[model samples]
Target chain A: MEDVRLLMLPGPVPLPERVLQAMMRQAINHRGPEFGAAYTESVEVLKTCFGTENEVFILSGSGTAGMDAAISNFGKGKKIASLVNGKFGDRLYEIASRNGDATGIASEWGTPVDLAALEEALENGAEMVTMVHNETSAGILNPAKEVGRLARKHDALFVMDGVTSVGGDEVLADEWGVDVAIVGSQKCLAAPAGLAAVAVSDRAWDRIVEDRPYYLDLASYRKSAHKEPMQTPYTPAVPLFLGLHESLMMIKEEGMEARVARHHRMSASVRAAVAAWGLEMFPQLDEHSAYSNTVTAVRMPEGVADADVRGTVKKMGIEIAGGQDHLKGKIFRIGSMGAVSAPEILATLAAVQHALRKAGVAGVGDGVEAAAEVLNP
Target chain B: MEDVRLLMLPGPVPLPERVLQAMMRQAINHRGPEFGAAYTESVEVLKTCFGTENEVFILSGSGTAGMDAAISNFGKGKKIASLVNGKFGDRLYEIASRNGDATGIASEWGTPVDLAALEEALENGAEMVTMVHNETSAGILNPAKEVGRLARKHDALFVMDGVTSVGGDEVLADEWGVDVAIVGSQKCLAAPAGLAAVAVSDRAWDRIVEDRPYYLDLASYRKSAHKEPMQTPYTPAVPLFLGLHESLMMIKEEGMEARVARHHRMSASVRAAVAAWGLEMFPQLDEHSAYSNTVTAVRMPEGVADADVRGTVKKMGIEIAGGQDHLKGKIFRIGSMGAVSAPEILATLAAVQHALRKAGVAGVGDGVEAAAEVLNP
Candidate 1:
């Protein structure tokens, strides 16, 4: 019998059974009406999730592909300000620097972006601003609205990496003045990994250049999408698209407002459990920063090895994520994104509590009960 | 009841049952050993399909992504001679011209590349050469070996777009001195569309530059693939990778030689049917160039409308391809690639014959019988 392992990672969250079933169908002609319907429907749902009336296009790559397209299309050869607070933030900075003349406005991991520095950069001729809405690496949700305001004030094009936020959290792209926003299928959308959906404001479209990478070119995508029987500029991952369509339908069934609320409740339960366990949360939040509603990061207790807790939980068939890069072994994250519910959250919490007690962590409390109370309440 | 349609287009071919089943599994951790093992196995099989000992990397985009990477990585800022005889060949030239100082060596559609033009460009200091191995658009297999030889003679790098050829046709990348070879999953591999495999020779690797697109960077793919658990640089389209793994395994089970022979026999049957129907083959092959074994393009009969023939067949639950771009309505294409066998071929031919007869075409013969004779013989 196969071990039914629970995936509790930040992205690539467990898919719904219907989404998996949708992917099992035989191949369909991508240039035909059936695919066109699915593609157009997915784009419609994506626009709602992005909270934008702007044009949205799907790319056959990861979230990074969407990020690359956003920057390369509108930010290339321009002065840009990139904010870095965690792994994904740094990735945006790197991609921005590679494509344009970018300046990194550094902030500590799990901390708020340096607003003064961003304003300084923008005032000093930064033509674009790049930011990560939800930093999954540190489980921090950055202030996208504030940053968008600053960018709008400076008359700079704003590109937001909403990979883990759009479908699971609140993201009003047009209201926030975001020129471009990106989301990954495997994150809050509850679809399998690989597809990236990007929304582009008319402002960004007017400024987008022609000299860009062929595969990630946004203009080509727009052109092909407007054709009869809408299609991608290149061949899409057909199965993944099918899965995404199904998942997006599910999202529609459970309205985006309800889904975001569920995510908030789930993450709050995990935080309640962490507080009950006498464990500290990883991210130190400021007024403009908050705990991510998709994933909760908790610092490793004193004298407890990361392997002892995370490995022990893994042995019990529950998989969580350890800290990446410099924060390795210092923290563990529990994802509450996608279609995750009370049952999965409770099961994961029970396993984590058992592992923590088994690892001889002193003063361990009833974390599961605390989590259950939050769930029931 | 849903209509069961047979896809006879050049790509997004009908997937095998096992491949679809493989893609139905729930998402797994992409950074874990399970994904690593699957990715490693897929790469090993891709090497065999590509017919090279050189390193192969799987990308999460379409075949165009591979083409973009192949050109932008090594051909940027260099002098490139792009051979254009079909739509795909024109695409290569377009991409090359966008990235490098490229010159398109042109020929009419459904005809061989102009060798003299290519030679002149090489003699005038062209540093790289690009050709499409199997031009799916025109159903003509370009002379990759001859083009590779010419490139080698001039000490230039050779890049072959083997998108529709590598798995089902003969593509000896190393022996042909191809510096870079790319294949599409949906073409000959019978996998879902969206994944592309690229095999890169060391010579090309040595010439690859740093200043290229971030998402399609080959160096990043190489670095990530070499890590402990083999992985793509970014989050891969996980379900497509699973489907590709199953399809590649099926190819290995059938053996490349047997697969190529099957493709040759199938396409020969298609050609045989065209001859029996008193229709003309579209491409005028040169001494070196030959009709493509993956797809067969046939000129539409005089006084027969493309919509009348193809649309009628499509109404009968069958799908064949019409000519692209300028060739639209001038010819029709039949794909005999992927896992197609006698049943599919016979059914498609029967429908096409019925459509043609209904459209008032004279001199129509028993094409199904002719195809069956070739299939059995």
Candidate 2:
């Protein structure tokens, strides 16, 4: 008896059987032709998926490693401006501060980053600017394009943490003037949680100095990628690469335009269910901030402890995430990203409704019904 | 319809079906109690496997990342002596050179590190000494215990890269005075590639200072591992962790002593087969330079091209490794690590014999017969 739970976290989402089967395949030599072809193909697919013609590399680590790469590659001795709207955004700032001279343009957790504050930091002689496309912690999608424009205007390199956005949202890395865009395999890619894909622009490459961290060295990645048969500087997580290749193929088959549309539709349904449940969204849903298409952060109702809400759902073989950092116990998050279906979303909503009611909450109109209205319509 | 090849390479060796199945398990929340329990259990198992009471932490990247961690954590502004006998030893030196002042006590490939040389380097006021236990690139097992002793005598932290040795070889971390021992999952652990486990002694912990690479920061790893329920500072490779847990369980069931004996037996059989085929061993078989019990390096016979031999064997659904760097084309390697069996070793020997014949370089007696003698008597 396999007791499978709904994986509704921001990452490590439910992987397809095909992807898992790919991962189960025998490992190939990292320097061999087999891995070379796979690496080259995967990089090309990732470039297409991220909407960037820049150099893309797959690192054998989590998204945070990619973030570190972004920061360490160009952060040294540079005045970096990090836009912080949520936990992940703050992490970028923290990483920048540790590796470089960085000034954080902080914002309220549930609000989008202020554009003027970022511009002011850049004007104050910041050489690079880092922003998170989707703040999974607060369930808010920051204005990446608007910020990118400011970064370009100030002649600063623009780095985007697209970990929770690239695959599920509209991330035109090149079009948005993003010099570097980083994504994780486990997020919307629906592979596993071991690989991070980072696309670096030519401009960013030009800015990269020799003092980069060896493990996170972009030039090494570039040289390896440029090899006739692509390779990594070190032994890669081969199974993760195979799984990512499968997931990227799936993304290609689904087409990025259709994939983004489907995410929009599914996320809308979940938001409708939340609205029907009379729960407030954690991030302010306004013109300035876009609600994350991947995860929905909902404020917990009075008397309903966040743990009880998540625990009850877990009892029903469904997993939802709770808030991080300062918002802990005050909000719960439902991630509807990566290979999630309408039926699965409806079942999750029904389970959430039951969980909420069991946690001393009432008067929530049938959540599933509300979601169905959006799905069918 | 199983077209399985003999995965006779250094790592990513043939994994048991149970380990593959464990890796197939659905994703779980990283911050959940389930992962915490799993992390705690895996760390304890790793400590036992490593033959140490030191604090162990599993990283999401490859063994190289662990090497980076070891160098960056303690080598900051400190003088480090790297005993280089092979490619991996040089890597440790390179890592140290980038992060700290490092002196390389270099030796020829396939030669065991000279204890006197290492002691001399340590005597030069070096604060740390790094070396590889089993040099996968050269198939030479360095005298780690002796080197560790030298390091201890000089009051230098001993960092051991046990990537190809930990699970299958005798690695008495504490007994050998190894302050830091790093191992990867894919090597002798028989798990998929991705995760690296590092055990740190109290002496090494005291030497850790700030200004280390952010991602490889040991203090963060220690703080997370010491959590009420163990955790990683960043998102870990969950599937790899699950696979490692299964592999660790397999190690426990087999008993470490039995496992190491089995590896020694298998590697000896392969070496015997190579001798029967009249192929010279790559590394000098002497009292000092011990051949690896994981991978056996065989010098190619005259007129027998390395690729031709490997290709011929691969045509018979067997995969062996060619040498790396300068040693490439000069030697071929047969890996007998992890979950390999007696039958598999015999088949590989037979395949190698046939391949050598096909390469027009065979006047040697039955290789399988030679290996069988070693296996049986």
Candidate 3:
């Protein structure tokens, strides 16, 4: 069989073989004991991964669905302060604004979130404040903990979008005082895309006035998940849950600290290689700007079209992502989230250098050496 | 390996090996041409399965999520007349009521929908009517076509819960004049649970006033689906779509008419075996009542405990279902949804007979013989 393309996109990450096999297991009765055990274990494992003892519900949708649950459950009729620095952050603001009265603290694309502006918004009349822990669109990590502390100071509940960071970064959900933290299975979990996990604190639950949408009703999810045979309110994506369970087990085996370090190592390696290739980083390159450990965004080289680079990479049986929305065609992103390792990262850097050379770009100084410098160090 | 338990539950039907392998296929870039082709093909196949030339969108949640999209998209502030005869139907009413002004036309759980009552409600200033094509909780098929005709007569859009009937039985969405029909992946499609499909008519799309609840926003789904590289508004469950695509291909191979016939045959055989075992069929077993072709509800014998029968069958490596909600402990259901065959049906019946006999029930007839008669005939 031909080798499968390396999936280095922000999500739907290249799944481990065991996780894939878990998804291939025979169907089980969702209402039966087998599924009950799986569901119960999945919730516990997800909480452990999120670093929270608060309530977490595994939902049968994408990360956006988790974002919807967080916003719709507590944002309706409430004063919401949303921080927007990238596409996902914009989505958080959009979801909240659609549901209730929301004030957006907007930041320029590719820029770090302004905590002072967020604090000002929260100090107004905001009851809930939303922020993305890692913004994939900009390849930057937001000041989630700082935002959480500010929200707490202003008596506003903090809802965090940890879609790309929860399992890959040091996301201390409870310690950071986040009321709701949302993540997707396909991100750092190394599972298939289809499941979203939402960690809800008592504060977020208490703010739910009524059930808005039936399918995404967090109150119902909490009630059902607390049952003896813990389960979601509706029929879950059983195979996806199985994949997640296996992925979480793999994470447990790796240990959270090791996983986070591995991700940081890969991030540093990618950034070094991009620098060696003489390409500008998309997000501000500074200590305060906070580069993402999950994905690295680099500006496209002059005279090298984004499509040509991506097309060449695809021909080499590797897949990465281009910039999204307004940043499309301006930058290319290399995602090292989930099951990605040093070998895969080195291979990706090599392929991009080859693609760049083919596009007549010069000064692509030994990509492998640059990446190994950080990976070995 | 030990034989897996026979998943004879309504949803999460035993997946074919090809479908399972398709799910195990490596993740593809959601924005790439590969997923675009898959998405476009899936939409076409789903349209074929629903027998509709109307618009179809693949969503990343349970059937309940599809129901939400249908109601939330068009039912907000519109007078809705919802027909409720079972749990799912009641859920439809609840979803619609939460979104808009709705009046429910309630019916006995195990009885068919009262079309006259629905018509009367529609005539009384109702702008939309919702009904379930097959109510799994009650193991009965509602008169959806009749209700659709009545809804049309009253100038009301008809939304249907085709969750259990879309692929298992006859569901001609366009011919039945269904403005919107919702189905789940795990049900008759024999795909893993995680995805929902909504087939919407022009009328339904025209009625969407505002995009509320960002994730379930149908307008956004339509817009993205119409793009060059067709895609979901959010990250879709890619593996589930792959499995569904394979399952749909299998359905196409079997031909819809033959598939429907096989489901009917299995339903008849299960009903016959129950009768031969001196068990009464639930859901007002009558010609007019239209028992579900996908699942059959059987009353528990006087001396037999529900758990005892279910446990015995489970021990024999088979999994059937007990009644849900109000019918729990009173009736048990035998599901013959996708991929079920005569041998499996006969084995299930024999196991049930053995369980009944073990429960101190006397004169347990040869259930295999009864089922064989229906299968062989």
DockQ (C-alpha based) per candidate is 0.75, 0.58, 0.69
TM values, all candidates: 0.99, 0.97, 0.97
Per-prediction share of native contacts kept: 0.90, 0.68, 0.89
Q: Compose the digit string of candidate 2's lDDT tens values, residues B228-267.
A: 7688999888889888888998998998999999999999
Candidates arranged by lDDT, highest first:
1, 3, 2
| lDDT per residue as tens, model 1, B63-137 | 999999999999999999999999999999999998999999889989999988999999999999999999999
- Candidate 3, B1-377: lDDT as tens digits: 23446878887789999999999988877766778887887787788778899989999999999999899988887999999888888999999899889998898888877777877787788999998888888889888778778888888899999999988899988988999999999889988888999999998877886746789999999999988889888999989998998898898889889999999999999988887888887787444469899999888888678878988998898888888787889889888998889878988999989999889887778777988999998
Residue B51 CA error for candidate 2 (Å)?
Answer: 1.2
How good is the docking of model 2, as DockQ?
0.58
Question: Model 1 chain B: which ten-residue window has the lowest total lDDT?
Answer: B1-10
Clashing pairs for predicted structure model 1, backbone only: none
Q: What DockQ score does model 3 reach against the true complex? A: 0.69
Q: By TM-score, is 1 or 2 better?
A: 1
Residues A331-371, model 1: lDDT tens digits? 99999999999999999999999999999988889989999
Residue B343 alpha-carbon offset, candidate 2, angstroms: 1.5
